[model samples]
Target: MTTERRVLVYGANGYTGKIVSESLANRGIPHYFAGRNREKLEAALSIVAERFGSPVDAEIAVASNNPDELRPLFAKVDVVINVAGPFMQMAWPVVETALECGCHYTDTTGEQDWSRAIAEQYGQAFADKGLLLAPATSYMWSAGALAAEIVLENKGVDSLDIIYQIDRGLPSEASTKSFLRMVCNDQLYLDLNEYAAWDWDTLVDVHVPYRGASIRAFPWGGACEPIWYKDDPRVLNCKVLTAMGEHLIDGVKMAIDKFHEEALSLSQEEREAWTNTVGDTMHQGEPPKDNVTAQRSCIIVGGQGQTTTVQYVMNLSAPYTWTGEVSAEAAKQLLAGKLLKPGFQSVATAFNHRELLQTFHELGFTSAPPAPGTL
Candidate 1:
């Protein structure tokens, strides 16, 4: 149990992992790019060196459900920033190992089930050990949570409605797999401190603050917010809805529903195999140059109470770039001994909103005041 300022980026060969590695390298942070394949790790290290003008380090470590194989790797680093997914299949090994090694852990998981499992099952264990186990530390949920927190800072709001949107971006292979897994999970929402199941087919048209147009969105388990605010007495309800480029109105919903229904009929192994097949075919191996440069993400959070209301909207460019920056920053915070409390924490609870906003601002994200007639 050595207290050292070092990090290990697992699954460093993945698209988001490469970006995170580059971010850490640009910041001159000491880290190891680790994955199962030696060749991929070497290639990722080369890319990091070529892009950042310097090389960090590299390791080949396979994450297994068995903690024995992962404990040694965890012992070598003070913090582990896991960018791997289908987190439902992979997160347990890395997380369990980190806890065993008494190391801080964070991941870029957006799966509500996975996030909730960590928070409810492992949160107390991590807290008992005084080690942070923050998941969903990426743009998927963190961006929205940060925006919601900003509104809740002073205002006494009890319920929230969040809409998330992204433009001109393609999903990476890992992202596609994670999403497929997400679609198969149960949909839920928070209602006055109780968890209630929601129908996935239900869609509503909402105004996207960033796009300045109305689009159809579906309930997305109120991602991370309900879980984050679950025990807080101030919040009574939270609902998160998400949409992307006409997907809901188009055939995407039908396709997703079909897939979900079919997946429900398969065994765990069969479902996993199907997921890999789809991910391999549909996953964007590398985003188009234009997409990476021109993509943007937006989140609108409206918190309403009986008598008062607050709203916040955040627009960020280059979603993957921002994910890398945020994940790298969280790793840095952990390595610097800044995480005082340990538990399954949201990004907003683990990090300062003002500082996060400053980072977003530095990275060219824009925030606007509440929309007209918000209250």
Candidate 2:
């Protein structure tokens, strides 16, 4: 086995993959791009080589969504960063093969069902397979969650809430498609108990801001609401919300929600309904001419600590970007024989967080605002 800490980037054809690879290259980190499509591989590499103005040197391998080819791909690499998402649908084969090959797994998975499924279903298997499966380590959970954890360390963080809002730049046609494909995955709307719970009639609502525009947001998906809160004994209840709240955007997310629920039970009609709805949302971004700006995301973690203290909002960019780098950086550290822990774990449990934050500060990426309530 070559001692080169080989990193394999799946879905190297997607929008975020391009940036992720660029980020890796900008830092002079070596990684291989693997995907099911050959054309995409060639195109992606062409761009990477051109933009970086450096040697075009990355082993791009094409696996035809075939299990046989994927297995060997894993054995050759130490870490696999999966970007091809809508993971609840496209996750299995690659994930299964990666574990079977005795390689560690990590991905930008934001799907709640995907995360819980991997944990409840394959959590032990990954451990038994002697592999570490880290999911939702991207902009969603990693950056914001870690920052939130940092604030709560000694100050006492009993309940945590993470909200992400990134607008201003409209994604390319391809980018928008990938985003839609991701949101089209099965939605696992559950109560605070980790059991099956999806109640739209009653929701956890809060007034937040977007581009200085105050908006009312209700509970959305992904992170466990009450459970995420309840896990930390101090939190009696916790819920999640997003920029595009269900009530706020009636057509897009509402239809997608029904589709995800129906997808589990194999409902074709519901699936079509979701496809159409997403298509509608897609149509709105065809030309990107209007300078589509995004709203700012804020996470208000409210709990009884010095009387309902709320510090930094998790959805802020600088913190999100910083935390995001934490995931891959941490994985790189782990592969280098640094971080090691088995079973299901959030970003907070990943490393000596102070060092992690220091890495971000050193890079001069994103940062928190000034001290609050300090005269």
lDDT on C-alpha atoms for all candidate structures: 0.74, 0.56
The model with the greatest lDDT is: 1
Per-residue alpha-carbon lDDT of model 1 for 68-152, expressed as tens digits? Answer: 7678778988788998888878878889888889888889887888889888778999999988888888887888788877767
What is the per-residue lDDT of model 2 for residues 1-375, given as tens digits with 9 covering 90 to 100? 233647788887665565556556655567777788889888977776776687544678888555798877888887787877666667788778877777777877655656777777777887775567777767555655555555565344455554544444333444343344445543333234344444432233345543445544433444533322234444433445555433335544554565556554556446544554565665544332221123333555433354455555433443323333654575567666765565455545546555665665566544443243421
Worst 10 residues of 1 by lDDT: 366-375
Q: How many backbone clashes does candidate 2 have?
A: 8
Q: After superposition, which runs of candidate 1 have C-alpha atoms over 4 Å from their true positions?
A: 1-5, 57-66, 210-212, 220-222, 247-251, 267-269, 288-293, 366-375
Model 2 scores worst on lDDT over the 10 consecutive residues at 286-295
lDDT of 1: 0.74
- The superposed Cα distance between candidate 2 and the true structure at residue 100, in angstroms, equals 0.9
TM-score of every prediction relative to native = 0.90, 0.76
lDDT of 2: 0.56
